[model samples]
Target: MVEDRRLAVLRAIVEDYVRTEEPVGSRAVVERHGLNVSPATVRNDMAALEEEGLIAQPHTSAGRVPTDKGYRMFVDRLTTLKPMSGAERRAISTFLDGAVDLDDVVQRSVRLLSQLTRQVAVVQYPTLTRSTVRHVELVTLTPTRLLVVLILSTGRVEQRVVELSRSELPDADALAGGGGPEVSAGDEPARVVDAVVADLRPRLLGAVVGKRIAEAGAALADLPAAVPDASRTLVRRVAEVLGEAMSDHHADERIAVGGAANLARYGDSFDSAVRPLLEALEEHVVLLKLLGEATAGGAVTVRIGTEGPYHQLASTSVVATGYGPAEAPATLGIVGPTRMDYPGTMVAVRSVARYVSRILDDA
Candidate 1:
């Protein structure tokens, strides 16, 4: 009973401190919380909590504030997540679902999270490797040039123009019943390129879009051979470009940030907490490392003061989670001072991640 009572006292102190940004005295805790105890009992509990290094007196005669360890205890005590209100969830969905593309989804997520949490928000885009092939379009830009457009399930499109020549493509004169690289009937090259594209589109669509590519190497070995002799070079070059595009992506390092100006709210601790974190946000490497700590499950992680990889910003705290359909999907979260609202911030971070995940996965 004593331990439970002390925990209750600690919880009240943490909540009051976060809300007021001032040291919490025993009388204030008794007045604000329905702990059903006298000020004397609360003071004794506070003393016990301070003995355990959970709360501390900032001045010789001031009220107590929670320590880093205290914040960890407060966060851990949340046995179950606090669900956001229906209106908040609806607001998130309505705002995020309006995104026009994958990039817009990321940008909106960062903005919404920052607005909701009133803290710096960072969102990492899901990598291309996690996306499946949606569609591929081959456009005949010219007799010797083809436009390769690859679409992914994430609503992302990659386009590359591949230059072909008689060396790689069939000679125009050959298609015209002549044997040379010389231009024949104006429409011969166009007809030949279009035919090859028409044939290759179905073949590539049948393949996944990854390193194995528009046609995994093993599946594509016979592709060139399967096509007509005149289209072999065109098929080979188109497949090669797609293979390169599928493997050419890096989102782990790509981050969209917002609400950095919110750090100024730290007031007295602005120099100690806000300044360092603001500078650190510029170095995406640091933000990536912090967000990397967030796990794939919906579990919201809170890394408070010194618990994170960078100890230099000990006054900063991170509340983050991973988003996307993959096992190692990208991450998104908020960064703020330890004195911020933990419960509210955790809910905001988690809600934003879920909606963003839904948008990316269902796109």
Candidate 2:
């Protein structure tokens, strides 16, 4: 019972410190929180808490504030993560629902998180390796040139152009456009590209129906020889391009950041916190390190002050979560001072991440 009361006293002190941004006196803790105890009782509990190193007295005589350990205890001991209100949920859904594609989804997510949390928001793009093939589009630019577009379940699209050599084409001379034989329905270059795509598309889509990317790669491997001998070279080139798109680790893995200006609310005196986050935003590697552990599960991670990857931002905290299809997900979260509202920020970050994950799952 004594330890429980001390924890209550610590919780009250942390709450008041976050609100007033001042050292909380025992009288205020007693009167403001209605602890059903006297001022002397609260003072004794405060002394116990301070002795445990959970709360600190910055001055010789003043109310106590929570230390990094205290904040961690508060976060770890929280009984429940309160749900976002109906209005907040609807707003997040509506804002992200309007995104036209993958890039739009990420950008809108970053904006929504920043706006919702009023903190700097970071979101990583969905991984292609985990995404299923959505569609493959082939557009002919000319008799010798064709555009190959690869679409994925994550809403990411990759396009590449291929120029066929005369030696590889069965009817290269007749297939030429412009100064060559007039474009015809029977021999039009676009028709040739379409014929090849018709064969490639179904093989890719069928193999990846359940997110089997490797099977899709294997299905496409034989397409160069699978098609008619006339279009063999073109089919092989397009298949290679699509394979490259699937394995591309760089393009699909990128970070989107927003709301750096929110850091200013911490006050210039806390430049130590604000500046490091600002620099981390520019250096996505640091941001990735901070959010690296926030995998796709529905768990929210709270890294406070020195507990975070970089102790330099000792005055800052990170609340993050993973979003995307469960099989393959990316990270999203916020950065703010340790004094910021933890419960509210954690709720917002998680709420937005769920909505994003749902959107990608359905897409």
Candidate 3:
């Protein structure tokens, strides 16, 4: 366990270093933290911490900066997360209340988190693989054209179009020369489409809808003797959400952010370190993979320096929490730097995660 005075000094050092991006000396620590300790005594404790690999001097004459170990200890033993202000909570509620759809909520969340934390923000769309199919519709357009629509429990929608040739119709006798039946003058095409949909459900229900026509042929064969040469438009708007959920088994739902602009005003090393992280942000899969491992043990996770996947992000850090519906596995938390304002960042991350989980639960 960390002693209270040493922990207080450590917390003071972390907070000061994060704000100034400068090495902290014992005299400065004593003066700023008001620890009631002499500079000599503070120096002795600093030496002890350095010996423990918790802090390090950049050069022979330079003051100290918190090492990854130091930051870890600070996070584990010293930092007290500050709660969001009532005004801040009200603002978050108001902003989220305006969201009309899943996409709207996600976009709003990313922007709100970025603004509040002044850090890069990332948010994964809700996982859909475990979500049940809420509704499915098959619409017939012509003798050869059809449309398939799928809705999920998550309020996501996917659509596909298929074309059928007269030769493929098993019920060729029901049509005029297998050309298919022409609607009467007063008949609504939508009603006929609905009838066709009702007939197709038992055969196609819960089947994996693929991009190729041949993949769907087997299911089509089970249909009420449909025609051949069936072509499909294969519209898949929510394909990304489903594809990620299905294909990225080891991938956690997460967002990668490029908040380098926020750190750009710091020093050259910070700028250099932040650039690669920003560039790496484009690869969403890599970020999600890292978060997957972090949340695997069901704990708030923190990875610093080379401990994380992206070696180019060696100088940066990530602090994330897991959150989701009770039945679903947890999603990831906000990620930022080791030098980040831990108290404030933790509050923002936890707050956003709770709101996101609530939205998913309600959806």
Candidate 4:
């Protein structure tokens, strides 16, 4: 267990350093944190902390600064995040309530998070792989041509078309009457088409169908024994939709970044640190993988300095969390310098994540 006094001292140092962006001295920590401790006693604790590598001095006479380890420990134990204010909750509701669609929700989420945190924001769109099939429709355009459409639980739609030779055309009338009809070399009569439609209805119900035109063609060769060309179109449509949905979800595994301009204010370390981060933002996959870790971990994660893979992010830090329908969590959070205001940023990130999750859940 952490000593209460030590934790208090660490919290004071972190809060003070975050606000002032300067090294913290024991005197300053006591004065600002209102701790009932003498500077000399605090100094002894500071020395111990420095020895433990939780705090460091840039120079012999400089005040101590919290090391990355210090920040990590403080984050792990020293802070209790306050819930978002009513006004903040109202603002989030007001902003996200206006979103018309999934894309709108993502766009507004990034903007709201960035505005609230004053840091770069990253939001990953909801994944669709686990969504259930919603509906499938088959439309016949010609004796040999058909259109198939598939819709999924996630609001994604896909369509495909299938074509077959007229000779292979089953009796559409026979199918329409829910009866199968044998095919011959001659053109199918209207009654046979009706019977064929009637016969195929039972076979198509609730089955996860594929849209292989070749399969349909083979089925067509058997006449009354063959499936409808529309069935082939339906199968093709399902495959096409599933494939497209997966690809779209993969392509959209992105981070909606904001507040990059803030990095320029760092001056000296700006190019070395911010430039590479900006470049990495262009590679959506890498950012997705990074944020994916945070989401999967189900907590507020901090990646500091060189701990992150990209060398350009060495001077930066990322604080991320996953938020969505409790049943289907999605990721959203902020990226900023190691010097960022952790308490306030955490509040903003968690608050926005909750709101985004609510919006997606309702949608």
Specify the highest-lDDT model's number: 1
lDDT of 2 by residue, 1-363 (tens): 888888888889888999888999999988888889999999999888888889999988877889999998888888997898788788889899998777899999999889888889999887666677777777767767778777777766678887788665435334444232233445644555555555555654564445446766877787666555555677788778778777774354589999988877778646777777777788877888888666776689999989888877788888999888765678999988888778889899888888888888777
Q: Per-candidate TM vs. native?
A: 0.86, 0.85, 0.72, 0.71
Candidate 3 lDDT by residue in tens digits, 1-363: 336767777777888899888898888999888888898887878888889888899988777899888888887873466788899998998897777665677778778877888777766665544444545566666645666666545444556655544443223223223343432333444443344345445435544443222233334444433422111112221222233333433233545353436665555757767667666676788667555543322455667766787777777777667655443344545556668876677778778777766765575
User: Where does candidate 1 stray beyond 4 Å?
Assistant: 140-146, 153-155, 161-189, 209-226
Per-residue alpha-carbon lDDT of model 1 for 1-363, expressed as tens digits?
898888899999999998888899989998999899999999899898999999999998799999999999999997777889999999999999999787888899999999999999999877555566777788888878889887776566788999987667664445554432223455565776676676678777676544323335445556676665666778888877876766676344788999988877777755777677878888989889987655445688889998988888898888999887664377899988888889899889888888877876676
For candidate 2, give the lDDT.
Answer: 0.78
Scanning candidate 3 in windows of ten residues, the lowest lDDT window is 229-238
Model 1 pairs in collision? none
* Candidates by lDDT, descending order: 1, 2, 4, 3
How well does candidate 4 score on lDDT at residue 125? 64
Return the top candidate by TM-score: 1
Q: Which stretches in model 2 have alpha-carbon errors above 4 Å?
A: 139-147, 159-196, 203-221, 250-253
Which lDDT values do the candidates have, in the order given?
A: 0.80, 0.78, 0.61, 0.64
Shift in Å, residue 239, candidate 2? 2.2
Candidate 3 residues lying further than 4 Å off, grouped into runs, are 78-80, 137-149, 159-191, 194-260, 294-298, 326-330
Displacement of residue 198 (Cα, Å) in model 2 is 3.4
